[model samples]
Target: MAIPNEALRKVLMEIEQKSIQSSQQIQLVKAQIAAKKRESRILQLTASEVGVLPSGTAVYEGVGKMFIQTPPSDVMLRLEKEGSDLKNDVTNLEKKLHYLETTYTNSRNSFEQILTRAGGSV
Candidate 1:
């Protein structure tokens, strides 16, 4: 079987674009995770310095104020949920990318096989 040059080129181009988009999305997710993780770390340090539970839940008192330090825990939970969603999104993107790349490779291989059979004649 042979694939037309135009079709092959189109698939290859689409594959490249999809891969680039996926990569960019993965990078964005990583950046978001890093930001959230940094905040979590800072929260941990602050809690440690001020005396609080590291499990993100505990009762503590601050200077002239008896607060339950819930902001960090709340933010951490929200960020963690977001991170989980992004990780799942990345996994889906990777699967789509693999499919697209495989399509391109199969088309290119078919073209090559055609060329070989035709003795390199257009």
Candidate 2:
């Protein structure tokens, strides 16, 4: 079916906007994934370093604005748990990123088809 030029232009603009929004969302998700991976890596390094400490060594854990004395084993446990959680978060974010990328690609393809139908070039 053929659409009037004005209507086609409006539809094209809406599709372009959707594509841009999807692109932005994909970028944001990618950044979040990177940050999560970095955090996970830091946790692993911290755990490894802490592992080398003497068995009776004192460990301090930061809570809010204060550092409280904590057992080395407890600190290691917390780090391990946090690292696991961060890994899960990264996995979820990666799935979201994939979805956003697929949406962005589909929007671009649709936009191109609309332009072609309207005797226009992208």
Among the numbered candidates, top TM-score falls to 2
Identify the candidate with maximal lDDT. 2
Residue pairs clashing in model 1 are: none
lDDT of each: 0.58, 0.90
TM for candidate 2 is 0.92
Residue-by-residue lDDT tens digits, candidate 1, 1-122? 66676765665566566656655665665566566566656655554553544555553435365564455555455546665665666566566656655665665666566557756544
> Residue 99 CA error for candidate 1 (Å)?
0.5
Off by over 4 Å in 1: 1-70
**How big is the positional error of residue 11 in model 1, measured in Å on the Cα after superposition?**
13
Q: By TM-score, how accurate is candidate 1?
A: 0.46
Q: Report backbone clashes per prediction.
A: 0, 0
